[model samples]
Every structure is written in structure tokens, then in C-alpha cells.
Target: MSEWRIYRGVREPHDGIDRLPDPPPWRDFELSGEVTPFDRHADALGDRRLPRADAYKAEERTIEAVNTALYLRRPLLVTGDPGVGKSTLAYAVARELKLGAVLRWSINSKTALRDGLYQYDSLGRLEDAGVARELRGPTNGGPQVGERGDVVAEDVAAAPASEEAHSTDLGRYLRLGPLGTALAPYALPRVLLIDEIDKSDIDLPNDLLDVFEEGMFEIPELSRVADKQSEVRVRPADHGARITVVHGTVRCHTFPFVVLTSNGEREFPPAFLRRCVRLHLPAVDDDERLRTIVRAHLPTAAEDADEVISKFLSHAASGELATDQLLNAVYLVSRTARDGAPSLDRLTALVFQHLNVTVPTES
Candidate 1:
């Protein structure tokens, strides 16, 4: 068995599942369900949980952890094997609660916490400023009525910036990533999917603590110019929309619903563990695995699907194969079943082979 990195932090287990309140009152949401969550995609859900959804059969412990995270306004750290639906948990919750779209921030070895927050385009803003200066041609006139209506005549080069020009504040040059978008103030809390957190740098998780705890952050550029500008409409993760931040401060009305997924490839720090509600996802029973396979791939699969599922289950017992591989085998078999059994026993040998497993040849 692989070594599970032991942490020094005290374990904070989830209490009963009913501890969660009926959605935080601080957030702005159209109440619908018993505990309706903030949904970004209200139109997509349309009074339904999820349109194209399959049941996520998680154990009671896992469900309890989700509820606990929601109640405490903390992030959930889910660790499990690859293709074990760790990332899918975020989508499931968002759908179940009728929350809007899931804001996902996929992490990698080089991913930094700041990248997920916001990006300021200083160079681009500088270019735009230069263009504005160029657009103002030489005009020397004062208090003249033009054909359009009452027009102020002045030297274009010497004239002050218009209201539109002033509207382009420091925040206009900013684009919030998924993390920043989730943290942005909204009527309802957004479901933030931090996928593959284990692949991030060692410091990324620790860096996120301040934001998680405070439920807000500041843009240094915006902060510097805050005295000059009281409110700045900045672009967030969503396009064609702007969020007003006063004094360059963006605070969450409701703490974002964060779901951090890990593949158990690496261990997180003790401090990081303490801040999160962690859940260890285990492999499901073979029958349930087959059901997932059918739900995803062969929804119309005939009774013969059991034979292919059994083959996958057999290999899964002895080797390291993901559930997706089983789904793949089932899809191929069911699609071509009309042509007769086309060497499924032989196909499983090649189709379900694990990357690290070595199978001996006929000797």
C-alpha cells in the first residue's frame, strides 16, 4: 500500500449533516429549495437540479463533509484516485443547489495563487491611454454652438478627460480569474472548483489561507489609486460584466463555496489541512461502478453489458485501472454488439491495461 502522509494538525470531523443553515441570509439569492445554494446559472437549471445529470453515489461520510463545509463556510479538500469524480463534486453541488455555473480554476505544478485571482494589464492600459491622447486632434475654439447642439469650444489637446475616459480606472485593466470571480460579491455564493490542488506549488495552499479566512482581497494597483477613485468598475471572470470595488477592496458578501480536488499525488501542509474540511473518496462497489459506466457511456446498453463490466471489475481488483477505462470498454462492446461478440476477452487485455502494470505473455 502507498504511504498516506500523516499530518500533525488536529482532525476536525464533520458533525451531523443537518447543521447547515438554509443558505446564508447575508447572500442575495432567490430562495427555492430547502437549502438553496447560490447558483450562477439560474437559466440553465430552470427550477431543476441538473438537466443532464447522473446520480453521484457518495457515502454518508462524504455527503456529511460537503454539508459541514457549506455550514462552516470553509473549503472542501477532496483527495482520491484519478477519474474518481473528485472534480465532479463541485458540479454536482452547484446543480443540486440550483447554483449558477461552476467557476473552475485548474491548477498545475507552476500555478500560483495570484494567477487564479486577478491579472492587471498595465501595458495594455498604457497603450490605450496613448491612443486616447492621439484621438484628440488640435481644436481651438470656445463657447461655440455647433450643428449638433450647444458645443463647448476648446483646445482638444488642452481639454480635460471626459467622464468616459475617467470611467476607465485601474480596475478596467484587470481581469479576474476563476478564483477572483468566485470571491467577487454576488447575490449568491459561487461554487469554486479548484481542481488538482495537489499539483500546485507547496506554497499555493498556504497563500490561499488569508483570502479564505478574510473572504476578500485587494489589487495593489487599485489600492494605490483608491484615494483618487472611490469606485472602479473592473472586469471579473465573467465577460461583459463589471464589479464595483470601493477603495480597491473586493469583499465577499457571502463566502464562496470552494471545492478543492486532489489526486492523492502529494500531501498538503498541516496548516492547509486545518483550514479545510477534508474528505477521502474511496472506490465504490463493482455494481455501482457498472452503473456509473452505464450512466456515462452505454445508457442504452443491452444485458450483455454485465459481461464487459465484469471483465473490467476483474482487472480493477488486481491492477490500477480507472473507472473511465471500464466505461470505454463497455462503450465499444455495446456499440458493436450487433456484429456479434468481437473478441471482448482479447480486447480487455489491451483496452483496460494500466500504465504501470505489466502483464506476462503466453509462455
Candidate 2:
């Protein structure tokens, strides 16, 4: 493991990321050591319950693929069945290498490249502008007069400055999305999980090629006003965090470690595939692997899980069932048994149902 692995997947967090060699010339970016405080978005990113570092188990092939992607500074396209740890792979790598929270971009049918990059609240800005205008009087330059014909001195004094401040504050309405947050100028690369790419719009994969190739993106709103305001500080995808954008552009200090998961729902273009390192995760069918996973996640139930595991494997042999489903069954059975509840057989049956099987209705 010491020979070539930068990310040793033994479920132990380490500073091995520091040992990573320089990337290929084309992949190198200017380095910045500036540190910024940020709140981790683990909960919002849907990885709040990540498996304990001491519990996750990674296969040799998966480790090699991760390292290859890391050294080459390319995205890893992981295709596998649901609940087979495709998304968890990103979390595992981040845990082992001590990378900060994983930035996730979950895709849906309507997901576009910009959805992962940044979002500008133009409507919010416009509404704010309207409020500012109201604060200033109808005369275009003075405060509103009361019914008694007296001047509103406070409104007059505050309105012009408030309007000026709000009009120039573009950062208040702009935010960097997950992908954009991953490209922040950090000394160490952040781990990024682009989940379910197969569900994205047709053009998204091709759209990502340029960003992955150049390691930078531009915020058009900021770009247009770069001369007026050379720098803008905006919030990132993570909560309560801020990052600075210079000249309306963001260039990576290091290319993020990107993992794109797919469920084999669609095919990607050859050109897009050319830029990614592909890895296919094999199904977890063996009892030893299943037991290891069970122990990792449900240690209290490990002893009682054997019978449940056997039943799950038997059912899985005939139809599709996720690994999580097995864990769910084992957890319930173990809890019920301790509570002096009824038969484990019935509980297992309810929990281990096949995912791909559909029930027929009688007319």
C-alpha cells in the first residue's frame, strides 16, 4: 500500500494527501496558501451520516482508481448499482486523506452546468432596488412629506446612501454553488461528489468538459462589473462561509478531486469520456464482504446479523436488493429480539423485499 497509494483506504484518516506528488504539467495550477473559515455542509450535502472512518472498507481496485484520478487530476466516473457505495467512495477518500467536507452536486433531469456552478438572485436584487426607491421620496431627490406637510428628515438622510450601498452590493445576491465552491483557491484540493450524473440534462456532461479542462469559471454578473468593482466577496454553497472572486473569475489553486457517480441510466459522449477516469463497481455478493459491511455500520448487531445476512443474500440472488436494505433488516431484527418481540423471520421478510419486483394487481 505504501508504494503508490496516496489514499490508503484502510478506514484511517491521515495526512497522506501531503505526500501526493506534483500533477501532470497540464493539470498544474497556480498555488495559494490563503486559508478561509468555512462551515461544513455535510448535512445539507446528504452525507451527514457518513460511515465512521474506522468502519468503511475499500477494495484494492477502488483505491487504485481513486489514486489514478488524483495523480492525473481528472474526474473519476464511477458507474455502479444504487447503494453499492458509489457515492460513499467520495466520502471514504475524503475521510482517509483528511480532506474537508465533500461538496456534493446531486443531479436531476433538469440539472444544468450552471446549477452546479453559481446562482444569481436577480429577482431579489430587483426587489431590493424597489424598496430602496420607495425609501427615497417621489420627487426623485428628497424625503417624503407627512400628511401635516412636515419633512421626514431621517428618511431623507438615510435613503440616498442606502440606495447607493445596495446598488453596488452584488455579492449580497450571488452565491457559489457546490462545483464553484470546490474550485476555491485552497492549498489542498477539496473532495467533490457529483452524484447521479446520468440524470442530468443531455448537455451537462459536455458542458463540464471545458471547466474540467481549464480549472476555472467566470461569474458573468461579476465579470461585467469587474472594472467598477475589482473584487467581490460572495457566499459559497456551504452555510455561513464567504469567498472572494477577483475580476469576476475564479481559477483553481488545485483541481478538486471530483467523483461523478452513475447508475448506468444513460451513455456519455466519447469526448466527455475521454476526459474522465472510469471505474465500475462490482456488486457486493460475497458473504465475507457483506459481513464486513454489516459490522462496520451495525457493530452492536454484528453477532445477530449472520442469519439475517444469509436470508438477504438468498433473496438478492433472485432479484435486486441494495446493501443498505440488508443493513436495515439486520438492525430491526436485532433491536426487536432484545425487546422480546415476535419472530425475526417475519421482520426479515418485510425488510428484504426485492427492489425491482413489481406486484401484479387483480382486476
Candidate 3:
């Protein structure tokens, strides 16, 4: 709800620390739409159900890698097991930097590089064209030019010719995907979350190399008409936000702060790995993580949080839980218990239970 602040108290000394650019080198950007700071709308940065954005407990190494990526203009490749706070890192950076809402591109087995760049609604455009043509004038039922009918040539020419129809404008039907939107020539670099990229097809990671290197891409659909038109307004990834591009190409003014997260489901190519600033996220130190979750969410249950966190850690030892599970357990204890009662063993067992682990039956 408030402006997010990153805790730099646990700062780590990184290579080339003294040489880091002030305000980053890539600050000269062209604004495509309204420029708003993240603090102005911090509530929309992440899922409201989970208040994890403000409580991102970053260690020295991650912050260093993030800075290195920013300075070098390389994507930050964050690898970790499920729920180790890999995806959350992007939101954290965007919130800290006052970058607008993070553009998220979720990956799956069928995902490809283009899936993140743009989505062309060819069918929708065609359907809309048919409707627009009819609205302009009756397609078949119109009488001869001299004959009086529901639609007349003069009326059609005078009324519709002056108006621009979305169907006729190919750019109108175009929607920039999260990646493409982030690449728009905005004054501030957008935070892009390439979530769970390892789940994508093998070629997906390789396919992004060219676009990443070039820092721009062309919309072939719009390019076809670019010879006659210099500028075209198209929809960006953000709802209701449109960007105008010269010659139908979207180039990044400031290379996007790309945070690519992988759950270690698959290995990337050597070439891809070389271009990225890799960060492996291990499970956070228990005491710190516990304190973070408790302090941010359940301050009332402070006295009993350590005991609850210990139970959660014991359950997580079997490799079937996530950090959020501990949060859930702690939040529940904070709510269900009024007085700091340590007699929540049964509740902890229920909350922290992993489905894969066989629970002993009553004898």
C-alpha cells in the first residue's frame, strides 16, 4: 500500500562496485505512455492476497547480481526450486526502482519466444473488418445508387470516410505481449518477469537471443503497411495502454530489466547462459526468513512465531514444502490464537503437511 523500500543493510561488496553508474547508464528513454512511479500504485504490483512484495528478504549476493545485470544490460537468470522466491525477485526490483507494474510472461511446455513478444489477432481483425464494412454501407442489400434505400452512397462516403475504424487499422488489433511491451521506448526501463522459463520448450530460450541482442523487434503484420505509414498506434501489454511506433518497429530505449526465472526443470543452451547474469536461489536462512514473514504479516503472534517456524522447517526437511507454506502456517497461528499459546502442534501438523509424505494412521 505504501512506497516499497529495499533493505540494503545486508549489502555485499561486488566486483566493479565502485564503477557502477549513477542512476544507471541507460536512462535516456522515450516515453510511450503515461509515466507513473510504482509507489503511486504499489498495491497493483503483485497479488494482493499475498503481501510478499514488501517483505522480500534479499541477501547480499542477489542484490549484487541484480546491480551487475543492470550495469551490463544483461538478463538476470534466477534459478531455484519451486517457491524459493525466484519470481518474487522481479516484483521486488520493480517496486524498489519505482518501475511501473511488472510485465509477466509465464512460460509453459508449449511456450515460444514469440509468445512473449506479441500476439496478432488475425481472426479477430478479419471479423471486425466484416462488421466495419457492413457498418460503412450495406454489403448486399443496398439499392442501386439512384434508388432510395436504407443506405446511400453519399451518406456512406460522408459519414464513414471521415472516421477511422479499428478493424482497418492493423495496429489496432495488435497486442504487445509482456516482453514486447517492456521493450517499448519508455523513459524508464520496465521490469519484465520471464517466469518459469525452464518449463518452456527447448528452443524458447534460444529463440530469445536475437531479440535480446538487438534490443528491438519489428511487427511484420504492421511492417507490411509501413511503406505508406510512418507511425502506428498499437496496444501494449498493459491493459488500455497503447504505444505509437515509427515504421512499425518497437525498439527499447532503455533495455528492459529482464528477470528470467527457472525452476531448474530444464537446462539452457551454452550461448544463452553466457549472456545472462546467473543467480542460484537457495532456501533462505531459516531464522531470517521466519523473522521476515512474522514481522511483515503476523506481528501480533511474535512470541510464538519462532516455535511455529521451527515446526515448519522440520516439515520442510522432507522436500515437499515452500517458504510460503511457513508463511501460511504462521499467519494462521497469528489469527486463530488470541493469547500466545504454544499448544498448536495439531494445527501445525495439518497446515504444514505435505501430500506426498505418508501420514501415519491411527492404530
Candidate 4:
């Protein structure tokens, strides 16, 4: 039994992560004593996506695997069927550890590595340059003089100076994505959820290897201007917030706790798998666990949830059904049971339908 766990799975906020031992030499970043600016978006305590403290019940194995990933400073690759709590695991860990916010990067087939890193608004910058040029007007025409013999057009030069500064401001055109924000040099590690990596392009997994190992990334737009301006303030994934990037590079003082989820949609490359700690979440098959989950989300309906759970288990045994379907059935039954609704049976039938099975309908 592994008792040296930092994330205890109890859903109570604690600083046990402070007790974690130093990382292996190969994984050490050596960026100690760096100061991170206060980010209200990352430090806020309330998140609607987080599971209720009293309702989520994580298995012992899940606890051990998370702690292992934390100690090793590696990402956790969670594979499981739908509704198996794979994605929710990241939020659970963030909530329990008092990690500010869970930065999420949702993946699709077109999602590239840079999509998670940062976005540069080149087109916007070009448009701003055009506006600045118009404001400066033509220098070819002789300077327009005022009624008192002062050059009014010369005053135009002063105005466009501010516009030229605005046009060349690289920070206004660049914003850090979720992955980039997670790599900011925070004293406490941020929780980063890379959801559905299996849905990404074939090369995306390979592209992330360098970033995961190095704990830093460079922005080319800012890099080109590094000679003139070494520090630039840019927005993070969280709106209305700004962070300073020095020398066009963003590095982590503390390695972030990363969770990559998959729906078993596709296989990953062997090299990519080698760097991540893996965890497979089995389906929620136990009757007691189902009740606990229901109670956590909807306590008022839990008293009569036994009957719904039994039917849910019976349907689950025959075909694939998500845990949320069970919760839906329980909520509807508890709400409509007092009315003696005659359509209760039909409603439950629709709620518990197998995900993989298709039923014929009338034309």
C-alpha cells in the first residue's frame, strides 16, 4: 500500500502538496525564487464545474496514481469510457488541493499544438498599421499652415507618434492559451486539463513532447522584438487579466499538474506514452457508488434512488449507459413520483436507452 499520497481524494482543501519531495534530477526545472504576478482568474476559489465536496468518491487506485504523477512531475493520461469521470478527475484534484483554477484545452481533429500555447493577431495588427498610416496622412504634400502661420500638419506628427507606438505594441496582439497560462511561473502548480487528446491530429501528440519535457515555450512575434523590448504584457486564457513575458519566453517555476483525457477513440504513439503516467478509469458498476454520486449532486432525490439504480444496473449489464443517465432517471422519478404520472415508465425508458443501440422510428 502506498501511504505517501499528496492528493488524498477526500475533497478537502489542504497543503499536503508542500510535503512532496524534490523531483528526480532529470525532471528538475531549477527555476526557484521566481515571482508570479497575482492572477484573479487563476486564484479564484469558486468553479461551477467542480463536483460537490460531499458527493465525489474516488477509488484508492485513482488517489495513488495522481500522487505518483505529482511526485514524478509528469502528466497523467486518463483513458476511460464516456461518463467514467475521466475529465472530472482534473477538477477534483484542483478543488481538493486548492489549486486556483483548472486551465482546460479542448481538442478536436484540427487542434494544433500552438492552439493550446498562444494566438497572435497578425491581421489585427496589420489593420491597425493601416489606420496609423492614414492618420499620419501624406508627407508628400506640403505641410498645412494654420491661420496664425503655425504648421497644423506638424501637430499631426505628434498625434501619429502615439498611434505608431500603439501599432508596434506586440503585446496587444498576442494572448496566451490555456497551456501557456499553465506554464506561467506560479509558486503553486496550476492544474491543466487537456481534454480529448485522442481526437487531435496524428502529429499533435508528438508536437507536445518538447513542451512537456522543457517546461517552456517561445513566442516568435515577441522574440523578433526582444532586442528592442525584452518584456511584454499579454493576456492569458482568462479574459481581463495580463501577465508579463520576458525575452519572448514563458517558463514554469513549478511544473503544472497536467491531465490528458481520452475516450479510447484512438491509439497514441509509443514515445508519447512513455513520458506520461497512465490511469484507466473503469465504468461505474457498483450500486453503492452510483448512489453516492447521485447523492452528491442531487441529495433530495437520493432517498428513492435505489429503484432507479437497480434498473440502471440491469440496463448497463446489457449495453453501454453513462452514469449521468442514471442521475437523470433518479431526478425525474423523484420529481414526478408524487404526481403519480402515468408517463413515468415511458420517460424512464427514454432516459435509460443504450448509447450504442439504435432503435427504429416511424417515417
What tens digits encode model 1's per-residue C-alpha lDDT throughout 1-363?
111211111122112222335545533333221222233445263433233233444555766787677767889999888767787777667665545677789899899988998987766655555455456544453323334332212233444668235324566578888998887776556789999998899899999988887787887666766766777777767562577777777777667789999988888889889989999887554676567546644567635678877787788877677776776777777766465656888778768887456768897
**Candidate 3 lDDT tens digits, 78-104:** 998676788888876766555657789
Note the Cα lDDT for every prediction shown: 0.67, 0.81, 0.69, 0.81
Candidate 2, residue 151: lDDT: 24
Off by over 4 Å in 2: 1-3, 31-47, 52-54, 138-163, 338-342, 360-363
Give TM per candidate: 0.77, 0.87, 0.78, 0.88
Off-target runs (Cα >4 Å) in candidate 4 are 1-3, 32-34, 38-46, 52-54, 139-161, 338-344, 359-362
Off by over 4 Å in 3: 1-50, 135-159, 163-167, 338-343, 354-363
lDDT of 2: 0.81
Instruction: Using lDDT as the measure, name the better of candidate 1 and candidate 3.
Output: 3
Ten-residue stretch with the least lDDT total in model 4:
149-158
What does candidate 4's lDDT look like per residue over 150-262, in tens digits?
22232234345677567667788889999999888877678899999999999999999999999999987777668877888888886635777888999887789999999
Model 1 clashes, total count:
7
TM-score of 1: 0.77
Off by over 4 Å in 1: 1-39, 42-53, 137-167, 292-297, 338-342, 355-363
Better of 1 and 3 by TM-score: 3
RMSD of 4: 6.6
lDDT of 2 by residue, 255-285 (tens): 8999999999999999999999999997789
